[model samples]
Target chain A: MIIQKPGIAGTLESSDAQVTVEPGDGKIEFELESAVINQYGLQIRKITYDTLKRLGIDNVKIKIVDKGALDCTLKARIEGAVYRSCNQYNDLPWGGAIQ
Target chain B: MKNPNMKRLRRTMMFLNAQKPGLIKDPYIYKPDSIMLDLEDAVAENQKDAARFSLYHALKEIDYHGVERVIRINGLDTPYWQEDIRCAVAGGCDAIRIPKTESALDIHLVEEKVLAAEKEFGRPEGSTLLMAAIESARGVMKALDICDASERLFGIALSGGDYTKDLQTHITGTGIELMGARQNLIIAARAAGKQCFDKVYTNLNDTEGFRKDVETIHLMGFDGKSIINPRQIRIVHEIFTPSQKDIAFSEKVVKEIDSKKAQGIGVFTVDGKMIDIAFYDGAKRTIELAKASGVYKGEL
Candidate 1:
């Protein structure tokens, strides 16, 4: 369930955020660029980190490009990318997975 | 979400594509009586999962604030419908709209999945509801059985495009091609004591034609119409509102009917028009319609 060849998730459209994940240096390093940086930068980063935590990934280089996505859309896109990167397509716990 | 009411005002149920975050996010702002998050014809085959994710979130997060939330799932004939139900239930949508439904089995099959999803998601059993889209000649013919198939069914909607295609006829503004099917479906819905919605008017640009169709369907005894755009909402609601004279006379009849029944008068006359117990329900319903349409300020 560890980072399998750097998974990416999310979209770059307005009200959506795009995230790219890769193997990290034994620590969670987060990078974010958002049109609403002055207002919602921290909120975007927090959503990305929380999604990663729920998916049980402790360390990864996560890049997020935000177009002002709502919390749920951001969460889904990140979750999609993580699952896609790990090649775990079947039996996704769509609502939320067990830790 | 408000608790499911078998009889609710759904004069305009607008369809929003499930995958579009922007559209699904705040369609309630337009104030359609119901918002149908579509996972069937609107979604691309490859994007079903993505659409489900978006749909689940929209249901969970959007505070539609008294607007009925209906999920239009893929047909029972597809592999995607079961999962679609799970997502809809988990997200707590008010009802499931089954597309391409032709028989009672379609309702029963989806009802079983809905019940299973309710249990799996810890939702109250029988909390979710269902309605069918009569899309073909077979569906039109079997509309009665379909409407009576389950108690979860609140109504049946006429899906005109598929129905017309099945008849192999072009849709003229006259609506003659669909007259029989429409009449048969409405009669079936009425016989089952269920609400029926007219088919959508697809010509977005034809306001004149849309107005005529709405007038025709409204007079055909449909409870409502499946409106595709916001521009159509006000007109449908306006047309469906009981007129001042109709509402005033209905109120009088409803009140007099109550007193007459107590006096054991089985029949009477109001304004020289014959009145009886049979007209009581229709009169009460007109008052209800007037109140719902914001046209009645009278104390009924």
Candidate 2:
């Protein structure tokens, strides 16, 4: 639930987003850079916030470099980076926290 | 929708890295019989968890048209396989491939976990099917047990890369070193009434060599092949598809066999070839393959 350390996941592939997360100062700090920022930027931001909320993290600095990744892919990248940041590898809550 | 049939037509099972959204998002466009969403070997060690996240999400959201979605989980020897099973089962994968399977006990172990995960995820108790990859000498020697390990197991596949290493050899392209394992695996799979699949031919440049390898496996009675690329899918399907002549002959043989059996005759000849009850299944299989390949016009 806590972003104890910095964690990063994903790549700058054609249909992927590289997500980076670090501990933030008592509030969610989100930044996004995507190819389709004119159209899907708000949707991408909402997905990141919702995914972070699901994982019980509201106080983290999350940066996303999106290359036109879909909603599912964005969520996966966020979950991956969040989990890695917390060093919680075993007993992953697949459909629970990660969903 | 996820394919429900356990023994459907699977001429090609294309491997895709679960970590790459670009790769897994729309692989069904290539029209492989199945897509092997790999969480093992294809993913780097540090990226295992990341890959699982990608895999779970893809399985949940992606529309694979009619292509079977099979997840290749991490091996049993690692701590990753359990979560891999849980993720794949929760994501509603059509099947889970156990890497480096060596014994019946290994299959049983995975089956137990799969059942538990299925219950936890509220999936049908027996909906999650399984397949094992024989990647070692021990696995090949114990192929029958692996096939008979669980009713959930629909088939077995040869992992040539690792199996060859265990055999103290490398890929010779001629498949001479793999002849024994391939023969043994298909025999075991047939004996257990399960499908058998050949390994991926890694050489992308040698199209001719790939064709020959596919032909050999097709002649050896393999139900399908593990393909690495979309280009290879056509080759496998083409080789596996029964020719029009073969389909026609098979239909005639089936009809003739039925008439002969009705007349209380067990032996006869069709088109100058000796026919008997033993040849009936092979003939029927050809017709079925033709139907699956969309080449059959005869009704028998």
Candidate 3:
């Protein structure tokens, strides 16, 4: 899926990436193939896990394709993807499927 | 080397405590994610010794829960810097904010001294992290090298006041003049795989302008922005947080993607737009922010 926001907050030039997240029965998968990851290693994974756990997602698979994305861009992209997949945008203060 | 379960939610920290007695009490009580008790810029020439003593005692006595304690020592160029480093290390600071770093050599200099002091004081050798304050044009130019200088380095901050003066540029609220510098710093920090922060916005009374500036900086990709006043902390935090509408939309996207994948669908539509693996990635990030900001309380 291609998600693009021409004007977003923060420095958007150097730090941009593509991530892939898939959820299943009590298991979510994530994969990342980011230039940022190739350059900086798996630092963004650390941030992603932290964010997912906090959201109370215990079983997940995530894939990312990074191109030197910043913290905000990483967060925004992951968030947009999760919301789109879960179909929980209409509800307030969402409680995830597993919980 | 990476812990998958670490949250990116760092508290907004403000630097405080100088040679002056009443300065700490000037800002609101119990705010900011952390407070850097500075014996550096805010302290006067004669009061360095006293400030160190006060800082040590304060660390020993103060109960700053949820508030990380950091110390900014005098720059390495000065005679007082060594002693300042020793005192802060001995005083049990969370990190040492080193100033005017031009290269990795500067970080190593302070790291060597800090290590020696840690050994002498029976403190753990790697207990303290180093924060590099990039001031001056040279420092900005070599930020990436300085960031990767040591594993002890945790974060890098833009010292706007000194940087501007050193570059012979005037400071402005719009910060258009500092955009290149800011972008450079962020790029360097990211390249080095470290957290980068924006410089302090000096206009104390211009709360609206400050908020706008924070949003701009936040959008530019900074983890956090420095604050001279307690008032600015909340404003920065608010701007950094993801919105309600954003959270809901992200949730919908994730659900739809999952349902489609279950039916062996590789691609689908959301709101009349094509959806695929890449779209799922952005949706997950929205959920992550919602979780970080306490908007989502679900299973990971």
* Highest lDDT against the true fold, candidate: 2
Fnat, model by model in order, equals 0.32, 0.93, 0.00
Which wins on lDDT, candidate 1 or candidate 2? 2
lDDT, candidate 1, A1-99, per-residue tens: 477777665556677667788878998898888878889888887877778888889878888888878888877677766776787654566566621
Candidate number that wins on lDDT, 1 or 3: 1
| Local error of candidate 1 at residue B202 (angstroms) | 1.8
- Candidate 2 has an lDDT of 0.93
Candidate 2, TM-score vs. the true structure? 0.96
- Candidate 1 regions exceeding 4 Å error are A1-12, A20-29, A59-61, A86-91, B1-4
- Candidate closer to the true structure by TM-score (higher is better), 2 or 3: 2
In the range B129-225, model 2's lDDT, one tens digit per residue, is 9999999999999999999988889999999999999999999999999999999999999999999999999989999999999999999999999
> Tens digits of per-residue lDDT for model 1 on B1-300?
434488888889998888777777788888898888999998888767777777887788878988899999998777788888988998898999999999999999999989988888889987898989999999998999999999999999989888899999977768999899889988999999899998888899998899989899899999888888889998888788889999989998999999999999988999889999999899999999888777888888
List clashing residue pairs in candidate 2.
none
Task: Say which candidate scores most in TM-score.
Answer: 2
lDDT for B280 in candidate 2 is 90
lDDT of each: 0.85, 0.93, 0.69
Task: Report the Cα lDDT for residue B189, model 3.
Answer: 86
lDDT of 1 at B140: 91
Error of 3 at A36 (Å): 60
DockQ of the candidate models in sequence: 0.44, 0.88, 0.01
RMSD of each: 2.6, 1.9, 25.4
Quote the positional error of residue A12 for candidate 2 in Å: 1.4
